[model samples]
Target: MDAILTPAGLLQRSAPATDAPRRRPTREEAEAAVRTLIAWAGDDPTREGLLDTPKRVVKAYGELFRGYDEDPHAVLDRVFEEVSGYDDLVLVRDIPFQSHCEHHMVPFVGKAHVAYYPAEGVVGLSKLARVVDIYARRLQTQETMTAQIVAAIDEALKPRGIAVMIEAEHMCMSMRGVQKAGVSTLTTQFTGVFRDDPTEQVRFMTLVRSK
Candidate 1:
């Protein structure tokens, strides 16, 4: 996929592709790095209480960043064209996700609301959730994550239009600098007809805001 900066100044992927290849550290190497961090924080990594902490952290990292192991396009490859002429809007809202911030390695928890206007086909509703999870499992920024979700569906499904909005609380902000607890960050992306038509955009917001 190609990454582009949207008008909102968010990084967005244009198409889904296999994850890039990179040299990965071995488990021992990862544990050693965690040990270094522990010592840097003035903790004795070798102490009886902390001796296994590095190992545990390394294992946890594997689960936390498993998005690298997945191909989002694969999840969206299956399309069902027999919609029986039902083509309005397919929206999946309030998809809960957890991701670590790439800059701080701290977590941000959020919900994503995804909507697409089908041109001729539709995929399973669950597939949209899976796409969100595939991206959420990686280290991210909320703006970029929102754009990526919309891009994946737009490219794979060729939808008439797509919209994505994400609302999140970043631990890096709440637990550290400025420490404004309960504050939320919001980001959105729109494409195709959703970008050209103001009424459709308003309708999308209405549907999203409706209880």
Candidate 2:
């Protein structure tokens, strides 16, 4: 008969292998993949309008999904502790972000509101926006994007708490698919004290909503 195992033993046995991390596509590989996708969409990739499209798209994607190449941790590596004893909520709002929805490959344009209570340090206001762009420029779901914004800042600043809210209109919903016209989507993610505390969360919401 097989011996019974403790939860820790079971977990250890079930751990994922670390031998191989997935490889990213080379530039040529990426371009080829895009060309194939263009063909599959029933468009003449060789047409005058599209003759150079693959190259252009590959370049565009290099910029769009460049987040895949960057480490979010590194993006927030440095921190500033010269708060001058100012410990109130630090709010950065109305940061414009443009992203593509992974499901439909359509655009979503909107603003991100990011805030955090510093534990020991803080990051530049613009870095927060850059962090938002790093995540937004990729194909992502609004939910994940919202969480990533909060998580990146949380990691960078070691904040007491972090709140991120995104409100955007998706072209996938407006232009095609369900075609909801002007309907917009809202997604929010809270971490640390923001998740366990009510007043802090409400204040963050009120501030962002005022925008």
Candidate 1 TM-score, true structure as reference: 0.90
Local distance difference test scores for all models: 0.88, 0.80
> How far is 129's C-alpha from truth in model 1 (Å)?
0.9
Show the lowest summed lDDT stretch of 10 residues, model 2.
Answer: 5-14
Which one wins on TM-score? 1
In candidate 2, stretches whose alpha carbon ends up further than 4 angstroms from where it belongs are: 1-21
Query: For model 2, what is the error of residue 174's alpha carbon versus the real structure, in angstroms, after optimal superposition?
Result: 1.3
What TM-score, computed on C-alpha atoms, does each candidate reach? 0.90, 0.82
TM-score of candidate 2 on Cα atoms, chains taken together: 0.82
CA shift of 94, model 2, Å: 0.7
lDDT of 1 by residue, 35-122 (tens): 9999999999999999999989988988999998998889999999998998998889889999989889899998999999999699
Model 1: CA > 4 A from native? 1-21
